[model samples]
Target: MPSPLPSRASAAGPVPGRYDRFLILGAVCLAGLVLPLSFTAPPVAIPAIAAELGGSPVALNWMTNAFMLAFGSCLMAAGTLADTYGRKRVFSIGIVAYAIVSLLLALAPSLAVLNGLRIAQGVAAALALAGGNAALSQEFHGPARIRAFSLLGTAFGLGLAFGPSLAGWLVQTQGWRSVFLSSLAIALLATVFGVPRMRESRDPDAAGLDWRGSLSSTAMLALLTIGVLEAPERGWSDGWVIAALIGSAALLALFVRVETRAARPMLDLSLLKYPRFVGAQLLPIGTGFCYLALIIVLPVRLIGIHGLSALNAGLMMIALSAPMLVVPFLAAVLSHRIAAGTLCAAALLLAAAGLVWLGVEAAAGSVHGLIAPMLLIGAGSAVPWGLMDGLAISVVPKERAGMAAGVFGASRVSGEGIALAITAAALAGLLQLRLSSAIGVDGATLTQAAQRLATGDAARAQALLPQLDAAALVHSYDAAFAWLMYGLAGLTAAIAGVVFALLGDASAHEPAALAEPARDDRIELADEPAC
Candidate 1:
């Protein structure tokens, strides 16, 4: 079957007045800020949460994973809903739902309850993000539209840049619950400011949602994450672990079949036909592992194992994330001078170098030595973070720009979720290797010890293994962490080589292909198709 054309909105109703613009921007910006804060803040609170509620490392990992996996999985469907329904209506409902979920999260009684509520929170995040971005496209024009999106990016960056520190402070002074309370306040403000001022908009010819494609994709990611997260706890050869991995593979095949068969597929599987486009998608996955994984992993290492206070851990995280605020703008400027593809590959190389440096410093137990390497990683990752979205669509035909953007966005967030799961598992597995060889512990005892120590719960791990002392556990952790870093560096360097080859010489022609859109509206013109 031929693919359905993307929908186009009818002429927008009366545009918001000056006062109304502030309300609209304020609401969406707040919503934007809430997304990253909800995502990045919880890792710092994991040890605290585990202390209070009691949870295994797998369950603790889910506190962040569940939210991200659900958010990334449901994002395409949420965008479809916004278009089929009304942007304003969907945005309103999403903010309200976010507020309610945040409130419930603040009062979560158990890890199970928190994880379930986190899923709800993730869905709400998807709704708010999809609706808010769709509404912005309708309300703003030309430079105003560019400025609006720039502000949205700023809010998102600010959340990422400061989320850990703020959460650290809250978890230090108030409690882990205060992080959700903070999210609740932002959602409430977004509702008050945005819901009232936003004008309703929707595509007149939006297609029905692609339920088969959406469900299959979401299930595939869920199963894969579950399989990876559980592998370290239950040995990879375990029957249940095998079943989950096999189930995920089956769902992956199902997702491909569904997308290929659907009239209006959530992702245009055909886009994968372009080698350059495939390379572009890898950009996100590279950062997801090299950068985003550390957003959670490092905090656990610092606060849980190193025994730093939450506030100090958050402050340390700044060296790893603060460059996001400035470097992206710098990248946007530098793209005009350098080949975007060359720039991206160089950025990854820089991150790889930083990772190696970090491994050396961390293994040596030098806290101050970590700062420069962390900054380098942050800056290097930020360059690609700014350029990949534009590169995704720019490499595709203009008609499929909407599909390319949707796919890239999905890949970006979903890749981060999968990366987090895989990286956490790898850390635990490596730690297990060291623990087993050093102490001859295996099975549940070995798995439990590795998981706990890997996640920054050294006290519990020691309790579980009476023969293991604090010094030994810390030594094992450093060894595992060093190996994880070197492995990531090698992976990143290899990705850089592959991307460089796939995108060879395209950089020379990129400027001409991108110039028109950059000069015209600085965005895709097509209305987003329903997923």
Candidate 2:
């Protein structure tokens, strides 16, 4: 009664017709790259884009956050939909939509339109990514699956690491619009290549989609992200900010309640019952914080403070990303010998060391001092990025792999969104403090000015603006970096603790089992009820 095993030709194994399997994998991975490429494009062209668009600094922040908010919040829903529909079908649709949205983005004449298109792009990306692991798992079994998964991880890392570089090249050669054009082309190609060969995977008897859970979770995430992203511009105590936080908490509570009661929950709440699952989820949260903070803050510090060109800053960032390129393969190899927890711990230590070194060195104005540390951070980050997917999936039943994968992806993205918000708040607070000190403005004066500005007292900010000096601005920036160092140090310590306590030593555990005994032809694609 174990649903009659799939036919040998369809089952995941070393079959003669497996060439098509590789093609499917390649198509999915290529589709996966589109989102990262889109997300990273603006950072490379922020200065130019802002100059042409005539937007304030905050607009730059929204450019990325808007996409992340939509993408992260909808991930679970996309996965659920994939499970209800067919993986191949959903993936093809997503690729087509993403391609169309990319074209729209390329033609957008205003920032608002571009951001709107980005949100649509995020939704499309969610759909494309939701079924990725399920499809990979179905195509390759045991050792083959491990390799494919490792490659999937590598693709993700490469997307982030290479996106800016690619964007930079496009911006330099054909202008900012070229980035979107390139993305559209890739998406189109993915659709063309994917639709023909990709096999469908859907559980015919899968539980109904949990619409209530999905809606509540989405509401919670959106409200929370909005609140956090807005706190820097609006004081923490602002009514709208407070309302968002309150609403987020209420919605999250509702989501938890609904999921607990739902027969078919969007998120499988029971997964957290396993210690390994909890650890796997938390590690990515920490990793997200480390990864995004470094990605966002490092370039700003380099270009804004060190007076480096965007190209030079980008190259320097490579030091932080290069190890990532190699880590996935290494982690895949190491997984055969070591416990993932142990490797994750070691990676965290390396990341912490790098962060600390970077913070101290940057505060001291020594770019050279940051290089070695960044190398360590890059190496450390590689371990988690490579292994976390395996760990997340391993903790769950094979039948729930699709849901587990969705949770893993959603958690990482959510962590990134939260990290950006927190880092932004920290940066804004640091800037304000530095600005106040440098300008010799008392807290009372600044508060009064800010209050007036909040009430449409543009004249007050205008009056205060003339008194701000260049040296003071520089001093403020210096102070902001100084404060940010404290945050970096704290994060390093937290990551180190989590890795050491939860992960332990790599040599302590046996490798996960690889091959299942079914014959090659008996392999059928895994059922993805919640892609």
Candidate 3:
């Protein structure tokens, strides 16, 4: 079982909390762990899911994309609901809903059914994450809040670290459906521990939900994701692809207009004016390029192109995620002494270097060459991951914690979805170019094969191009992947510079004036150290 988060009180806040508060932290942290499992584990199970359910590569791809799309797009709305209704109420509903959706996912009859359920699961996840994180901000303040979020980051790391390996074992032994059971069990535990003790809190001044902003933003994200995910399967020039892209742009403008005009906007457009706030938003986007993209892509490359067993591929992934287990806590500790912008910039630079190293190593096509680069990337990413949540809410007033959490969470998750889609599409397009040059196949044939290969459906990819052996496919994929890595490296490096400039030196300090508010539901802690 995962350990509970520390309840140590910061000097700026009141004393310490009772055991019940620890239970609340445990529940939220467990739920946090489950979200990453839903993400990282499923990629490891793709081949198993495809083998049993028999879906097209595009359909299999949507299994992940659909969930991320729903989760990312709904986060701001979930945050709004959390603040308007009650944080505890929304969290309870979300946890219950997540448990139900997990069961449905386990029993799904087809990929299509599973995809629909995954979308529901994503919405539930958004509610749980946004509500839980917002509620946590109410419970802690000053450095304690940073530690709380740091532990949350560690929980996320735990899931990412073990999810692939654990899912591999479950899929190998109990079948692919068992992966969902893991989430079901965790959700149940979270519900039991978190729901009963969590104190209900809401914004006293909140007017109501910003329906227009919610709908427009959600629609914009959906269209953008659809456009990116479809680009590889349908050519970029296809009418529907062009239409979706244009629709996404139009909706984005509509969303911006709606938010700016609304009396009580779901997201305050004015927050973007703060350089530190903008920098906090960019943190996840930078990690999306360097870390999250690899989480989706590398498993496919290892299992499908390299022909590794699910178990082996998953174990191999541990190298990339293991640093997450400790690096986040270390980064949090370092924040007290280091300027946050400098720390984050240095971390991103490290990840950029790792990406470049990985690109060189990938060209050699050896598993051993991957470890150092992956570890470096993971460690670098862990720094920003640990600090981002705390920094997000800290930048805004305490009264707007929900909105702050929502905006940051939305930016983070949606950036992930966009990065994954763009990376997949870019890989497919690059592979098509390689295939055209190498095999001289027709555009249609090359396109189909590249799409399948990009999504890790090597069996169908083989069927599409039976003339090419596995080695040839692997070679083509490696070339494309190497180029992709180099591009990501350059982008990551550039983002680091921008983040440094925007965050500045003042972003790290948590002023005591912004201390914890006294509330009826606030838990009072003892002055002693937490066990």
Candidate 4:
């Protein structure tokens, strides 16, 4: 297993003598970069978008989660379609759809319309991500694949790092609408390059479709997401919340049954048997829950609570995002020399420690206190983000590349949305508990107050609950934050241990021999235990 090290390659690690892989990598990276832009940029513009479009607090939450939930729900189905049809075809279609949606975003007359389009954008995003990652995993081999994934990580990091800063500038210069246009420009650009440059690839043996599996998977994700998002507004005991939860469970069972019986399941259930692959998936879920939660929440905290302008609020995050931009390149360099598990575990430990520190200071509403913690968390997170992705995709053979990438992407995006929802719900419940004791507000009023605080709408919170002492409100916010940060920190730290213990050896994940398309007709791929 060690003899065919990634450093020693099948023709210098796939795409042997040609630079065509670089072009493909660039196209994919371009698409990957746009996602963080869409995610982070909107947070800065939310207040503006809400004001112009006249949305309720719930509408605002949907503005963000709608995209994520739709994307997450459709990812597996999109992967199957990619495998059955063609990666390039799907990728190009996604780019075009994304561009069209982004353009429509600027023209939407109401938040409801914008939210609907965002869901469409999410679907397009799923297609692009599945196709892009599958293409990279299939074409790049050995160290080159590692480098390719790392580069993709770097692109993602760059998007995360710069998105807020750019959005703040754009929102200040142009209208809030410019943020959508900015994203549109990128998508249109990706389409131009992707159409001609991308190589078409598909699984020749793929069955048509798993209709029941796809339908059930979508219902499961959508219902679970709906339940979590509503938990903050309506009590967990609310009839609809309870029904959504039950329906989600039932649908998940049905999805499992269908997948197990299908000739070609949307996802390979057998992949779950590998501890390393599951562990790799946990990376995205934990990261989505923790780091991204921080990104989404912190800017709002800085802007609304600390009285910083959006520009300054974003600038403060430079400590976090800046490290992310450079860390992936370093990770790519060290991948050959270090064990992936050891490196990722060690880095996450650093991140967890940082999160704990950040939580304590963040609760007190101190922007200055967050800088060091942000740097620590950023450094820890960037190293492993791409590596974990490589781990997930590497464990599956090229034929199932779309499925593997879809799984990885789903974990990350769904985890982010779910984690944020949970964090917001927990914060709201705790904040209300604290406030009820201190301020004596009724349950319904407190629910609204908590929702406002969760969304970083300090202005709306003050306007609604003017009788509450300002000092008491801040204290309650901090108290809720304290619980969230510490819990997430401990959880993240624990997962670090799992990484070391679970991902024992990655040589087992080496790619099966891939036939050079131009040179050989011989192709050998196993359907199971590729890891």
Candidate 5:
């Protein structure tokens, strides 16, 4: 393939002395690796991190959630800042900040300090990673742009694939501190490569930042995420959970109101009117809610319900994860013949089918029934895994690329985050209800039986309530699992139809810029983009 970057831009070029895009792509890929590695590796180190810091379970959970909360909420705002102040400037500073914060995270003496530093580390990562992606979009076009994005996908996959094993080894060999300490290399590499080679680009006509929109958007997302994350642990009806859920909805509506009136909104509201962009945006949500939920639930079921060894359970996960990582790269070959929307919809349908297939296996209540379903889900997941990011940002102008990158990240993060939450809430709610009905007993015996059943202590459960109908309870649990899977399947199918309906053949493989926003109107940015 021809190089995506020219040796140098002509002095008279339209974008003004643009640097080699390949160098920027390199930086972006490295930055992309941060998320998957940060997410996957740290869990393996959780025990060590807690041991050294004298951590409580709450604090331990926050150690991971703190990073994600900060990272996910601030992404769009960070992108807007990158675009306004200049991508190169923000990106360079972010790299340095990331390095410093990561070091602090590694050496933090207290759990509180470690949690605080994780939050800081996440903010810094958002700046570097989003800025780098926007830089690539600004510099490259057409086939080169696609290839660069593919490489970013590859970097993320490699991180996910290698992170757990590497982190496990590092923790065993050196200490848990090695996980955070090792991240310094990623920051260093990105800064060294990006600071010089990344060209400065921003909306010169863009007005001041929309602090209102930024704060509201951040609060809305953060609150909603907190509510969801706490739901399974705290129970959905807990006072704090109820308040958070209500507060998030209120903030969301307020955020929409603020964006519409703001002189310079952080997220552009105008872009949402476009059908194709909306379709691309939904793709992540659909795939994420359906197949991603399977990834979370299946392993638990394998070990808990099916009574598989951890090793065997992991192998089943491989059936899902292996294809998920591999098929995206292969899907690129079909671009020449297939419309992007068609392929995207087809991918969602495949994933939907896979979810239903899993439900069927779940209904069978046998460990042996899972292999084919896992493989099917894995293959389904791979199809849109390659295309969703590009589809999200492609329709917007290159200048708004940072905002688009932020949107892309937010969609995936939110989708995965919220999907898991929804699935948990649904299953928990339905499980309790059904378990109560099927396990016919009154008073304390019913409550005790329910708890034991939830813990998978069949013998104790039977003893707790001799009247408990064994087959009835089993049917109820199976139904709960099936309810989640099949519901997700239907949702994915609907989203697929929306994508196929909204997107035209001509707009499918190509970025569709319907019309430029009037200069005076290009003030506010959207959560997704300059929508």
Candidate 6:
């Protein structure tokens, strides 16, 4: 039988109390903050940047996509590096690199320079983010681990939920350059505090870095991301799009084959053999789709259809995010008594109900109608997001914690990217059909108009004005929201079914598998007496 999980008091080791872990948590979370800040800051400053840089809407899209693509692709590589080298060393290096890149971004003279810096920043972010969960897994265990993990989830949630609003305000109060400078300062501080206090954690017995696996994975992700981003602008049938799809599939197939045969694989294919692990990984994929879809769809609906300013629209979306803060804590408390899978299923149901209410509200054309639904969705999402990491990592051995952490993080990021692509396709297709029918124009003409409008080419859109009407545009938006609602509902039902069917009893796994160890290996090494 496996041993029971260590309590919070024991998990802290010689640090004195549970509160001591907060400093380390803050340092780890600081690294994570950069990612959301970078992803969000550009949207607020896009118009100004375009005015100065003379780039089209596609150029601006690349600014964000480039970072996300690089960051997502590099995560597996970073994880391997952390496991082979020391986590603290890699994390600190990443922090320093991220800060330097942010400064470079602030001083970038042209769009090309900025795009290059964004990719560098993403590389740094991938290194830092890939090891965060492993650090926590090594440092804390049992109920303490649960609480610490919850706080980590809260930090990420707050970053996504509030990063854009903060960036918007910064752009308004200070220049766009201030955003990068501010993040740079935060990264520097994290490095300063983290270097002396943070201890290294990596299993010396782990396999060497999987270069082949990393390369194949990165190539696959880049091809896939580029294909999705381009598909909306280029026809799905375009040669370039088709080529990207084929290349991505081939690379991914190669990656799977490589992992299966590698002496020390980057991804442990055996994890999927367990039902709970599979369910845990899949739940995040589904939830990520719903979470990002609602986030993107709701804001666009509010700003474009209702004529609300960006700031106001972002604030309104807070109705959906505010409850996320509380639900995780509640879920943590509930997890002591109920199964993690059961809580996840319940959360999905609540989120689905919220989505349904949101659809009803949108169909009726009342902005105020969305508030309640947003709250429900927010509350529901909190628990599952908080619990997902724990669920995945719990099933693995302590020695393989870094591998588990790497895989879990990769799954969530990949899921978010795939979700974004799927949601974008659905919304774009629906918008085209509805607008074309309403405006009495062919689909091709309507798509051109929509593209012009999306790119902020008001003059061009006005010149083509006779081809489309205001009512038609509004109808197009309404149709997109309708599709989003249906997607969310279907996603929620699927999540519920998976949870109930696959994860009905959490106790099927050895209790020792669920419990934290007596001593944190990371802390033990850090506190060892010098020879």
Question: 493-523 in candidate 3: lDDT tens per residue?
Answer: 9999999998756343452122234322222
Model 3 lDDT vs. the true structure?
Answer: 0.81
**Candidate 4 local lDDT, 1-531, one digit each (tens):** 122213221221223235666777888889889977887677678889977888887789788778867887888788887777777777777878888999999899988899999999989888888878886776677787887888787787678778878888898899899999999998877777655655566676677877888888888988887887677667689999999999999999999998999988988897687676677777776666557778877876777666787667777888888777778778777778777767787888888889889888977767688999999898888878767767777766667778778878877776766777777677777767876777765767777887787767777776778877666677777777777888888878888888778764553235533223332321122222101
Q: Which stretches of candidate 4 lie over 4 Å from their true place?
A: 1-18, 50-57, 109-112, 363-365, 436-451, 457-468, 507-509, 512-531
C-alpha RMSD in Å of predicted model 1 compared with the true structure = 5.4
lDDT of 2 at 130: 76
Q: In candidate 6, what are the lDDT values of residues 1-531, reduced to their tens digit?
A: 355443222222254244546667777767666667777667778776787776777788888888887887777778777777766667777788899999998898888889888999988888777666666666666777776676667667777777778888887888788889988988887776655566566665566788899899888877877787677678688899899989999998999999999988877777666677677777676676557667766776777666778878887889988976788778878888887788888888888888887877877777878888888888888877777766666666555556666666667777777776667666666666666676666756567766554433334544675755565556556655666687767877787788767765552112224324453332223432111
The top-ranked prediction according to lDDT is 3
For candidate 1, write residues 199-308 as lDDT tens digits.
77654444766888778877876676666656656767888878988998998899999888887676667757667778887887888778887886887788788888
lDDT of 4 at 145: 84
Candidate 5 lDDT, 1-531, residue by residue in tens: 121222122222234244546666787788888767887788778888877778788989888788888888888887888778767666777778989988887888899998898889888877877777676666666655655565676677557656766787889899998898888888788777756665566655558677898899888878877887887767777999899989999998999999999886777778788777677677767766766676556655666555677567766667777774667666666655676667778878888898898788777775677778777766766666666666666776555666777777776677778777777666666666776676543555655554455445545656766665666666666777887788888988898888788753423234555444342212222212111
TM-score of each: 0.80, 0.84, 0.87, 0.87, 0.85, 0.89
Model 2: residues with Cα > 4 Å off, grouped in runs: 1-18, 46-61, 430-441, 444-483, 499-531
* Cα lDDT tens digits for candidate 2, 166-254: 98898888988888899999888777765567666654445767889878887887888788767756768889999999999999899
- In candidate 3 the C-alpha lDDT for residue 99 amounts to 98
TM-score of 5: 0.85
- Name the best candidate (by TM-score): 6
- How accurate locally is residue 26 in candidate 2, as Cα lDDT from 0 to 100? 80
lDDT of model 2, residue 312: 88
- Who is ahead in TM-score, 5 or 6? 6
Please give the distance, in angstroms, between residue 303's alpha carbon in candidate 5 and its true position after superposition: 3.0
> What TM-score does prediction 1 earn?
0.80
**TM-score, cand. 2:** 0.84
What CA RMSD would you report for each candidate?
A: 5.4, 5.6, 6.2, 5.2, 5.6, 4.1
Against the reference, the lDDT scores of all candidates come to 0.75, 0.69, 0.81, 0.76, 0.71, 0.71
User: Which should have the higher lDDT, number 4 or number 5?
Assistant: 4
The C-alpha local distance difference test score for the whole of candidate 2 amounts to 0.69
* Total clashing pairs in model 1: 0
